[model samples]
Target: MEDRYSAVVDLQGDSKQAAEFSAKNLNKNIMLEVENKDENELVDVVREGYLTTNSGFLKEDVNGGTCCVTALIRKGNLIVSNAGDCRAVMSRNGVAEALTTEEHMDGKANA
Candidate 1:
C-alpha cells in the first residue's frame, strides 16, 4: 500500500489520468507482491507477516504486513484476489460456491 500511496502522491491534484494511473499501478503492485504463487501461499505469507512484529511497522517490512482483498471489475467480469482468511462465494442454481480457497489457520504448516 505504501507503494500505491507513494505512486499517487505526486498527482495530489487528482486529475482523471492520475486516478487511472493510480488504479493501474496499484494493480500492478499487487501482482508484483505475489509473483507466480498460488492463492493459498499468498494467504499464508500475509498471515505470517502480520504474525511477525519483527520490523516494527515499516512499509518495507512486507513479511509482517496486513491483510486485504483485491478485486477488479472489467468487461463484466470480476477478478478477485486475497490474502489471509477471507473467502469469496457465489450462489448458482440455489447452491453456494466458494470461488476462493480458504487457508488453514490452526498454526500448523507442513514441514
Candidate 2:
C-alpha cells in the first residue's frame, strides 16, 4: 500500500513568504490535530488553521492566500476544503472529478 499527501497555499498577488508560512502552518496543524477527528471537527480544524495563519500576517501585508487541503483518515474517509481559487480534484478510472469549487476575486464560485 502507498500513502500520499498533498496540500497547497497560493498567495494572491505575490507574497511567497506568506504562502510558505500558511502552508507550513496548515500542514503542522493538520498533522497534530486531525487524527481521530470527525468530519465536522476536521472542518473546524481547517478553519482554525486558516485563522492562525492569517493572524500571523503582518499588518502591512496586503496579500491574501488560497489553500486546498486533502486528507485521508481511518475508515477510508477523505476530507477536502478550498479557501480561495485553489482547488482539489480526484482522478478515478481516467475521469477527473473536481472536489472543490474555485473562488474568484469577487468571492464568487466559478463552477
Please give each candidate's TM-score: 0.35, 0.60
Tens digits of per-residue lDDT, candidate 2, 8-108, equal: 56534555666777677766755566676675676666556555556665453567554555454545656666665577788999999988765443532
Best model number under lDDT: 2
lDDT of 1 by residue, 1-111 (tens): 355433534333424443344344444544554556565455444434333322233333222223344554434545554444566767899999876665664542210
lDDT of each: 0.44, 0.60
TM-score of 2: 0.60
CA-RMSD of model 1: 13.0
Residue 102 C-alpha lDDT in model 1:
59
In model 1, the Cα lDDT at residue 81 comes to 47
